[model samples]
Target: MLGSQTQTPPKEASSSITDKTKIKARYFMIWRWHFYAGLYVIPFILMLSITGLVMLFDDEIEMITYQDELVVMPEAMTLPVSIQLDKVQTMYPHGTVTQFIPSKAIDRANKFDVRLADGRSVLVTINQYTGDILGEIDRSDSWYQLANDIHGTLLLGQWGDYLIEIAASLSILLIGTGLYLWWPRDHASIAGFLKLRFSNTRLFMRDLHANFAALFSIVLLLFLLSGLAWTSVWGGKLVQAWNTFPVYYTWGDKPESHLTHADLNHGSEKELPWNLEQSVLPESNQHIHGAYTSSETDKGYVATQNNINIDSIVKQARGLGFTQYKLFLPQSEKGVYTLAANSMGGDITDPRLDKTTHIDQYTGDVLVDVTWDDYTVLAKLMAAGISLHQGDVSVFNKALNAVFCLVFVLISLSGMLMWWIRRPSGKTRIGIPPHFESEGLWKAGIAGLFVVAVCFPLASVALVLFGLADWLMFKPRR
Candidate 1:
């Protein structure tokens, strides 16, 4: 009975060995497809990686090149918001003002945006006292912008963007298959996982490729995934899911009767307007009259009801601890002068109130005042994300971004090197692994399913065509 059991055990072991062999063969076939795809798409991936690295430190480069224009005044009085607007208008009479970004930090001093008569937008930094245009920045002429153009679309626009998306998708597949290939079947040696002797050229190359990929795998994945999210359909869906909160801006109806600057200062307590009704005050009346206003005692003061001059308004804003303030002049009969103040106390990264004051052009009465602290939670998050992304959060953030750029360049170079070394040669060598092959129709079918699952429409179509070719070349044997 013991001899018979031993004989049965041998037969069972033989069957199990055969099953394991078939499974490995199947995996090998899938790996061949991945290898070929990586070889074909590597050049495109290399270009994207290189260009993306340059774009990471775009702000630093801009600062270095435009030092004269970017420098700020040592001690300029906070000019009236309207006076600043008038100065900008006087300097560029043909250009129309689009947006006035109140100074938030040293980098933002006297800077504002204007759209020229020729449809080109220009970012200008001006002298607050003389209103002289100190420096004009054209994004079209910027090297960083040029690099962004290449990184985003290879300078081919939407078509380039799509190509990048395809490359990213292929990279995911390549990494997955590469990881599987790296896994040893039963080798217990540490040398197999990490260390490799440089005596054999092929082994050195293979090890170099595998080790680099393993080391920077997570960062490379994040870089590719974030980029794809910007350019691909599925990636867009992923980003949308990540940012699910809605961004909404509410504006009140235009006031029925315009209030003059005089109407605001002497308004009767009996006729004090509703909060919503008073919300449309022109830009000039928004600053806190005193150094500070408490929530309980200053409800009336919060209403736009002042007729201060633009120069006085700027002084008041500065006095109230606002380092950066921008004033806008009303364009038409019903337009309100606007004053925007940023008062986070010189810490760009710190969250603070963004105050907007609307003052009646005719009357000096304040119409509407809104604060940054009053924004919805989602809106605040979005603002902070944008600031961080733009390298505008703080000096420390800008330095960190520069380091991130250097890291990105290293990652791209390492990835390209890995791809080049692992490229297959037609000749089969002893140390170099030969291409994997499919044994039966079922194995081929599984490979097709995997290709379709990863590549979506392109792989699905390619698989169908491959199947058709197979049928024509070798029909099933009965």
Candidate 2:
């Protein structure tokens, strides 16, 4: 019986062997792709994590840095908005007041964003209660803005943008394959994937990397997606096109302005909410029955009328159920008055509270009123995701994001170390995972490659380069 059993394997044994081989093949394929993606993602992810962590506390940092300018005692008799504008306009006669940001809390100074005639922007602080100009800061010189530029572009301008897009694209593959590999095998306890194995150096780091990455996998993915949704190619060109807010009504035949909200972000740290990512702006029409609209006169704009007109607009904003919103002043001769608020850090600090309104500068007609509910399904998701990613939504979210960033830094560094330590000694070539020959690899990969290429063109370019190298030097020899 033993000799017969040895000579002819049982059907169950044969099936088990086939399943094991299949799992091994799948593991190697995933591992290979994960390695390829990591090579490009590690440096950029580290930079993003670091800069993001810095930007998470931007509000608090700015408050601390500009405390003398931002603070005020509680008082009911606040200065009129026009008086504050007059004070700033007179000081920088060469400047135009673009936006007035009120403190969400009453007991604080108001901010005026002025565009100087010399082509610079400055943040002017005026005490609402005292009506005194407190301090002025050149907007571009802010530390957070510099860090934000680096986070977005590595300080390399457009080239930096492309590099980040490629890295961000490949990161999708990195995290996806990582989760696949991170799944516990054979119904094993959480020890391998969740619990860190510190018994051995390589195993300890590997386990630590796996466990932490697995823990933060969902959060990491959300951050990556939100960040990508802001990128030039994937988010701007592909996603934002279909996800942009659609205009529903028009008061006149006035053609929309060529500029979108993005035009406003040209020289500023503030960004438009994701919902307005691609909405065409409406232009001011001369037909609305009004003499220069609200708070206006025939001889150029001035600071007077006790803000009775804008207060009505504020009342209207309140009537629309807005508790907190920013009133961005007209930017040009035909610029509109924009009352904006979103969950982003600038305003109410809750993504669910998003609201934006654009009123004609010449006629004071409501051009557009968009609330959270008006956002596209994709834009709504991006709004919430972006708030979480920015860590401005909650203390817990901010702390969790910080932890994830730290863990990612550890995972990236330790991953490199693991490869270095475990590499085949004395080998001239990279000690890549053993890519055992599988007839289905190229065929199976084609579908994924095509999908990635369609979604992220820059990453596709990287993959094409890698594919060429693989076919030339790394393809398994039969």
Candidate 3:
């Protein structure tokens, strides 16, 4: 295809990708930033991937290990829920039942959470058909729970929370820059664009790093955003507070709760949606009125006389088409019964199925019923993204999540291997990409980052730390 007459060359060659030495300007800038982020993000991403893989199969693992508690012989007719409560009371006589998980399947057992007099909590399993006590377990000690705690707080509380936030912030840089590096070069062949093409280990590592990231970019980005939505600062203070479902009632009065969802959360993992976390727990007010109805209380409650039966509640939920739901018992006299289902808890992973309702303890009136349709725009995104990130949507989703986890680990390790292979021999220096001495662009990029810092203070703080580290250790000699 060579022409007899000389012609003006394309601004950049198509094969520039094969030679990193030929990369310049914005591409090189992106590569350098991506390199810097990988140094910090790899360890955390690795930890998350490993823990996430286990968490994806939390139900399966717990089922095998807790078959006695979770599985029971199917029966023609299960015993009434009250009879099962009596059995649970026998195991922990002094325990106050705070929550009840009714069996979702025919051969499964119901779980009751008891808060003991000594301030300890245990989950007592009850066989619905025979009303036999299966076994009790400390709520926080399970293998999957341990993985969840590590995934959330790294078992270090606030300090670990901050470290995770920084990792997530840097991953934004990593993913964004990785997309830039993975962009199809001018005149790139379809094979070169999509398939791995490498004669050397160096090319193999780079290709794996870029192509895999490119393939899973959308999933990785969603995981980062949804996971970050649980972080203390960015998620809790800034976004979650504003987007919470606004509690509305026909009655003119605003309400307050004796407790929030945080009080009932399972260890470090969030048990409720971002919207419900901020809402006040509703109380049964004597002045409020609804259609004539009865109410109920546990056996030990002060107003136990003519207590509303739990079967009635379950029947009502079933009537509403709730395939699965969690029930939280009222602690005190004024407390309301809370029944909730959302993507956050893996019951009907679609956000449109998100539903939470509080029934007045005394009146049996619906105090609040917040549905998925009530969530804010961003809250809706978080709900769907969280379900996808957690691999709870469907069978296909879980398989996809596992695959993504494998690709995620491959991307991180391959990039690390590439750096190892490219580093100069006998040099203590990490091979940071060379700084571009371009006109205006470098300064412009810094100004843009300053704007980003202004918007995301945590990311800005991370940038400063990375900049200081570079000045001390990675900066080239004069």
Candidate 4:
């Protein structure tokens, strides 16, 4: 009995040691992942945070930078829409006016997006009452537009988009692993929950990094998921495809044009609601009234006052209760006029008020009209979420997003600083987290990898490659 008792105590002690060893191994495994994720995501986080801030406050920036063009004196009476178009056409005789953005405020200058003869798009600002040419800015060259492009595509087109998408996807894993590391193991450790400590240099940086992460984890995740909906592979091809607005229900057996609402977008700058991007546009030209024809005038070839002219379109928009809106001109004879008022176009602050109406270019007949209520549940969420992400909801939203961006930069910098401070000096190798080899250590992470693969295929591919490289180059210390 004495021998059995001694043996039982040794067995319990051995089991306890084994349990602790596995726990430590798991910690190192997660920490290693967190480290690499931070390493790759650091630069991207900086770029995105900066560019995101620029985009979030694009209106304010433009107000300061282009006040002459964006702002004007308020007048009691405004010139007619056709006259404005005629004035713009007189200035750019060879340019194709594709879109007209009308400001609801009387003091703001009206905008006309014209494609010059050289195939460059420029936004021409025209005074509403006086019809004076304020100025023309290259749509792609504007600071806000450039920042928006970089924010979405990194100026590398599809390749840049893919890179950003990969970084964003892996960031999910970063947040997950970070949360796990921040989680307290016991009551004593719980004191540090979201509390920043500055007593020691390492602890200060650590606390800053971890605390900000914990503080903004939920909001950051919301941003990531909503932003992912714009990605080519995961969001566009998958989630977007699945949740795209049902055109059949709205159009009711009408023939669809080859072009979609995506054609309305100017590169990465989306002008349509998320669910409507893929919606098939309705064809026109079934009722071409002779009165609704284009004519050449001394000013320029402009749409005259007719049944389907620019004036009628403006009236139609107003009749439909569109206050601030954009009119996308029909491209071809069969193209339909698109009147859009949505948060995506920065026309309104509330996503619930989003509305898009397609009008027959020749007949002026309403083809299809979509409102916020027409959207699917997921689409509605995406619209509001996107508005929130862009800081278009309210002044408070802008302030919160700005704070988040600033803290994100701080967190990213602190993470890199901590890594740099801890890394071995004058060493070519990164001071990777210690690795422990235990039976099924790799297996423990398989479920997570599978989930990631299912949700984000590109991120999973990256994880696989990273895991293989780590296994080959860095053997377990144990």
The whole-model lDDT of each prediction reads 0.52, 0.75, 0.76, 0.84
List TM-score per model, in order. 0.61, 0.87, 0.87, 0.93
Estimate candidate 4's alpha-carbon lDDT, on a 0 to 1 scale: 0.84
lDDT by residue (tens digit), candidate 4, 1-478: 7767754458889999999999989988999888877878889889999999999888888778888888889888999988998889889887778899986677889999998777788889999889999998787787888898888889999999898898999888899999999889966347567787777777778878888898898988898899889999999888998787574365776668878898888756889998988878888754444455564433233442245788889998889999888999876656778999999778899999999999877767888999998888888999999999999889999999999999889989999888877887543368888778788887878987899899999888888888887877766421
Can you list the residue pairs that collide in candidate 2? 343-350
Error of 4 at 247 (Å): 6.5
Cα displacement (angstroms), candidate 1, residue 226, comes to 3.0
| Backbone N/Cα/C clashes per model | 22, 1, 1, 0
lDDT of 2 by residue, 199-284 (tens): 88888878877777777777777788888887888887889777875644332465578778766653635556875857777766
Ranking by lDDT: 4, 3, 2, 1
Once superposed on the true structure, which residue ranges of model 3 sit more than 4 Å away at CA? Answer: 1-25, 117-120, 184-192, 247-254, 286-306, 426-428, 439-442, 476-478
Quality of model 2 by C-alpha lDDT: 0.75
Q: Rank the candidates by TM-score, best first.
A: 4, 2, 3, 1
Using lDDT as the measure, which candidate wins? Answer: 4
Flag the better candidate by lDDT, 2 or 4. 4
Per-residue alpha-carbon lDDT of candidate 3 for residues 176-255, written as tens digits (9 for 90 to 100):
88887778776542345667878889878878888888888887888988998888888877778788755432223535
